[model samples]
Target: MTFSIPNLLSLFRLATAPLLALVFLVPENQNIANIAATALFLLAASTDFWDGFIARRINQSTSLGALLDLLADKLLIVTALLLLLDAERAPVGACIFIVGRELLMSALREWVAQNGKSSTVRVIAVGKWKTGLQMTAVPFLFYAGDLWALNTLAVGVWLLWAAAALSVWSMLSYCLALWRNE
Candidate 1:
């Protein structure tokens, strides 16, 4: 596949996921490491947003680019969540629920494709909002601690729970759409 600008952005985001996960593996200068990882995550999240916009603007949208974009999003999210789980910063049930929803959605998307119903079983606006919340919360959580008097971790935790609620809503919406053969 030709690596267009949008595709490259998606690839960059995808590459960032493992690096974000591996940051915790380095035990030296833990605070600095976390800061760096959080920066990388934010960068990745920016790419996730920009790539779609760029692809649409440049008329460079491709099947591969679309796949890479989705793949990068999933990788970045799951990687960050797993890392937070490892650090004991995120709730176990929430992490598991998020991951499980992602897996189920992926399988549902595959089934939709097999039945020639692409994008019909895809994420809804609530799901996109859930993703936005997740993208916002994950960095705050990664940089867990305080900035000035504000408790970053507490804010992130609350946002994450809201994101989780949105996740369930969106998941059910998709399932209902599929069930009704929409």
Candidate 2:
């Protein structure tokens, strides 16, 4: 339970997740909520990278920090997805598929761990790309802006689909690795 700087960053991200949700969920702040949520989401997502980098650089990595980081990411993305779904900015089917995949993957990972094969479910490059696309899409969707006649919502939707595809692909790869190790 070391309280390192990187862990602090993870905590900050965790703290912002509900804030981001509240901004979009509150009816009174409807007009300015999107922008504020976008800002908060981007800020929190950026810390995801920094926290990991800092932890490794300073030899401060801990199981708790990793758990906090993952929890923060899940919380933030889930909040955003729910908000988008409620606003009809994102398709409910896609959101459901993504969320379902996440749950399935989490359970799969736990199963792998319980079987003493945790190392088999290593993070893949596709997963990193999926996360990058997801992080990029969420803020654009939150902003919901138009730039040079380009509709951010449309672009975000495209990105979300790409991210989701990669997510499923990565999950399959992980599962296959675990299966192969068995």
lDDT of 2 by residue, 1-182 (tens): 67889999999988997788788878576658888888889999999899999999989988898789888887888889998988878767667767877888889878887988878977679888878888999988897878688898999999888878887888888888877888
- In the range 1-182, model 1's lDDT, one tens digit per residue, is 87899999999998998888778657588798778888889889999889999999989989899899989999999999888888878887777778888999999999899989886776578988989999999988988878899788888888888888887788889998888876
Q: TM-score of predicted model 1? A: 0.95
TM-score of each: 0.95, 0.95
After best superposition, candidate 1 residue 152: deviation in angstroms?
A: 0.9
Off by over 4 Å in 1: none
lDDT agreement with native, every candidate: 0.86, 0.85
Worst 10 residues of 1 by lDDT: 21-30
lDDT leader: 1
lDDT score, candidate 1: 0.86
